[model samples]
Target: MDKNVLFQKFVAFTAAVHQTTNEITKNVKSETITPLHYKILEYIAVSQPVTLSEISECMHMSMPNTSRELRKLSEKQFLEKVADDEDRRKHIIRLSKKGEAMMNESFQRIESRFIERMEHVSEEELKEIERALDLLHSKVFN
Candidate 1:
């Protein structure tokens, strides 16, 4: 195995992901939202009523950074904080309806553009790539 070939592939993959992110975000032109904000929204939309600490832990972000993002998201009406019934001092973070709608719209628009680029790859090739990615992820993360 050529280390240089693997390194080049890694670089190319990272570049493509960043490029796609920029392209999709450029189309949206949302002044109130950033990529990190959208990522937070994606997480909260699926798992709502979760604590701030939980978000920080799952996202591997510091408490201050997560808190700051949460505050900005709340100000944008993208997230709502609910007082935990059991613990008055704790607040749960959840996506507002507005955030959910935005996320759905963004996903559809981005998916359409991305799908266009996938036309060249055969199903077998896609499966191989998926398996490769899973192996790489397990090696790096596990």
Candidate 2:
């Protein structure tokens, strides 16, 4: 394939992903919590007491951006920073009660939206798409 064609295909793929995510998450009411914020919260909630670096790595976010998002969440009382027992200078992140509640609420909407959207596609098509997506994601991220 030509380079331009490849580039266009890449852009199209990314746009499709963004559109799908927006459709699902746009209805999820979250105050001052962007998808990135929810992503961080979900990660921390599931993997508690995780180091900031670990979260950053898992999210593929820069330290500065992750720290900024963490600051916002901390200010909102959704998450708390706890000093690392092994390293005092480093801090781990964990979701507070508020964060957990927010996560649960948002996740429900996300899951429901996904299911609703998937319902439109035939089972065979859905399975094929899932397999394709898995292959694509593995190639890109792994």
Candidate 3:
């Protein structure tokens, strides 16, 4: 399977993606939240109406710590905690309008940057990239 070659390619791919993305994402900052909090917000932006336990597990944080951090975001009006309609005992968390705007701001920059980067790529290669991404998502990342 050429596992080492595959691993090296993934490492290089991620390093390249992260190099630009990290800088573009840096613009989403606030005096009220730290980088960790920003990451939590960013994660929520992608996976909204998420639950506390899901965030905790995905963020690799303890339940208490996740709750505490979410409380801080909630206080700042960046997120909301609503009772789950399907499961009354559960609480679902979602980004407030402010948080959505914050993430969208960075998203525009990132999208523009990627578009510029892909300008040199041929349409056939772009199709190949799309297929590769789909395969990776379905088989490896899923």
Candidate 4:
């Protein structure tokens, strides 16, 4: 296969995934959380004990903006901060019990919708998808 053609196909795949995520998350609403806030929470849920700089970089947000959002989440009792053992000046952020619960519920809804949409997939296809995703995560996206 041509490299340019493969790149185009990869772009197409990413676009489709983005659209699917938007559709799936459209119904996911929180009384106090916006899409941006959920994006932060989603990251922290997966990579807890991370630092402010890490969050800011990953979210493509400014330090002040990320801190502001973290403040809100803390106020809402959705996250906890602990002093980093190695760096007392830096705080490590993690989700509180409430935050974990919220993430689990939201993820369940999203997973259900995704599964419904992929109901036509066979076991072999699912395994292939899993392998593809693993490869993408470890190689392309790493």
Best by TM-score: 4
Query: What are the per-residue Cα lDDT tens digits for candidate 1 across 1-142?
Result: 9989998998998899778778765565245687678778877866787899989988889999999999999998988898989999999888788887887887777778778767799999889988988997798545
31-132 per-residue lDDT for model 3 (tens digits): 667998988998898888799999999999999999999999999898999998888999999999888887787677778777887999999999999999
Q: TM-score for every candidate vs. truth?
A: 0.64, 0.70, 0.83, 0.93
Question: Global lDDT of each model?
Answer: 0.82, 0.84, 0.87, 0.91
The sequence of per-residue lDDT tens digits that candidate 2 reaches over residues 1-142 is: 6989988998998999878877777857586777778778877877898988898899998989888888988999999888878889999788888888888898898898888878879989988999998988798746
In candidate 1, which residue pairs clash?
Answer: none
Q: Extract clashing residue pairs from model 3.
A: none
Ten-residue stretch with the least lDDT total in model 3: 23-32
- Model 1: how far residue 139 lies from native, Å: 3.9
Off by over 4 Å in 1: 1-12, 29-36, 42-50, 53-68, 83-88
Q: Write the per-residue lDDT of candidate 4 for residues 1-142, one digit (tens) a residue.
A: 6999999999999999889889997767576798888999989988887889999999999999999999999999999999988879989999999999999988898889989988999999999999999999998888
Is candidate 1 or 4 superior in TM-score? 4
TM-score of 2: 0.70
lDDT for position 48 in model 2:
92
